[model samples]
Target: MKKNKMSFETSFWTGLAEGNPFREVDAFFAFAYLDYYKQNLSEMVIYSRKTKVYKQDNPSDVFVLYTAFNFFLKVCYGLQKKSKKWKVKDSLCCETVFHLTSLTQEEYENPFIVFQKAFGENTLEEFELFLCQIVELSLSPHAGDPDAELTTPYIHLIKMLDAGELIRERGVEKIRKTDQMDPVA
Candidate 1:
């Protein structure tokens, strides 16, 4: 939740130059999630401005950013699905999974494709585990003081999933039966 003054553009450029784009994108997402948790409009505005500048200055980087963001969302969706207390909307989760699967089929793939290859038939399970690792990382002491009431985006997300708060009202279906006269009678 702390304001991240580090320049995302610089980090991305450095990572790109060093041939380590994945790490940079992942780090950016972590910071973005922290900002989101804080709900700090000013910080978010600054972040957005910087991203826009970066995207304009370097168009190819947009695809890298898109892939990274989609991967993050896919992981989040997986976590939501795996939670016993909560379930992501079937359509939404299915669509994300489908997209990720398609990406894995491509020759030049997102970094998550490595997970798909490694997990084979149990890819979904592996993805959920990967997301669990992220949750654990977010909960680490260096991230913040766990006892603090203020929740980071990662904490809020985990709490929501565990609490089943994401489930829709229609998640539980009701069935009704009424007696009727037999037509053959």
Candidate 2:
């Protein structure tokens, strides 16, 4: 008899409500919002940019998710520097350095894993889930202009995305039409 290994979705995240977007992990995980969540990616992006739109949210432990996924290779040092430059807190800087040293200098860990363990992020799975939350906020009509959206995390995610440092590090060859409007660009 073969026993199946439980996934984080079925494990770490439990007691999901019916019709929850997370039930279709691919929607967020594979960027298949259209198929799974009935969401249009471009619309979501557009919705996210409208920072003034307000949303009425019901109280619930679970928050919906949508994500713009990007990660840099071997970026722990950059995280460290960010802490020093006051882009992030000092504790986060120390944590980044700690993970950098312990994961790379000592264990020779994989670059991808190292970034996940660094100060600002969690394990790869948790981080991916976090990205989904970003996507969720971007899709809401309430996400109109600043201080409008019902969700909070997406606001921070938008600010981070606006920074474009990661996008720059990823070395994008083509900028999206939506991105052309970036204040920094």
lDDT (Cα atoms) of all candidates against the true structure: 0.33, 0.32
Off by over 4 Å in 1: 1-54, 85-185
CA deviation > 4 Å runs, candidate 2 = 1-120, 123-129, 144-185
lDDT of 1 by residue, 40-97 (tens): 3222223332322322444454444333433443443333323333222333342343
Q: After superposition, how far is residue 98 of candidate 2 from its true place, in Å?
A: 27
Residue 23 of model 2, lDDT score: 27
Q: What TM-score quantifies how close candidate 1 is to the native fold?
A: 0.23
Residues 77-163 of candidate 2: C-alpha lDDT, one tens digit per residue: 233333222221112122344333223342222222223234344334444444454355554555444543324333323323222
Best by TM-score: 2
